[model samples]
Target: MLLMTSIIITISTIILLKNKKSDLLDLKSEIKSISWPDKKEVNQSMLTVTLIIISASLIIWLIDSTLTFLISKII
Candidate 1:
């Protein structure tokens, strides 16, 4: 079942990609129209994202440990 589903998805994606020449052209045009961020802004954004991810991971670890401790005590 999983193999069949994957084959069907692959075939459909191939068909869609083959049929999307005009859409791809439009997408290329739209991408060209975009004002991309400067190097310094990109660096700052990347740093912020890294810090946020680290902070979130620490928070999740703390919560998981606290929950595990409480559940152990209750049991």
Candidate 2:
């Protein structure tokens, strides 16, 4: 079983490398050309996202709590 699995994996890898060599190279070059964000920019974006998430969560919680309270009072 192990030998058969290894053989299958080897055949798949060979086919992939042969057929996708150009695609892989293109991807590598594209990755290299990407302008990654700097630490300050990333940090600022992260902070903004976190604040938005927290605000949304608080709003949802408030709405849920109000609904629950109203429903309980009715019951």
- Please give each candidate's TM-score: 0.57, 0.71
Candidate 1 lDDT over residue span 5-70, tens digit each: 999999999999987987899999999999989999999999999999999999999999999999
CA RMSD of all predictions: 10.7, 5.6
How does model 1 score by TM-score? 0.57
Candidate 2 per-residue lDDT, tens place, 1-75, comes to 999999999999999998799888899999999999999999999999999999999999999999999999999
Worst 10 residues of 2 by lDDT: 16-25
lDDT of each: 0.97, 0.97
Runs off by more than 4 Å, candidate 2: 1-18
> lDDT of candidate 2 vs native?
0.97
For all candidates, what are the clash counts? 0, 0
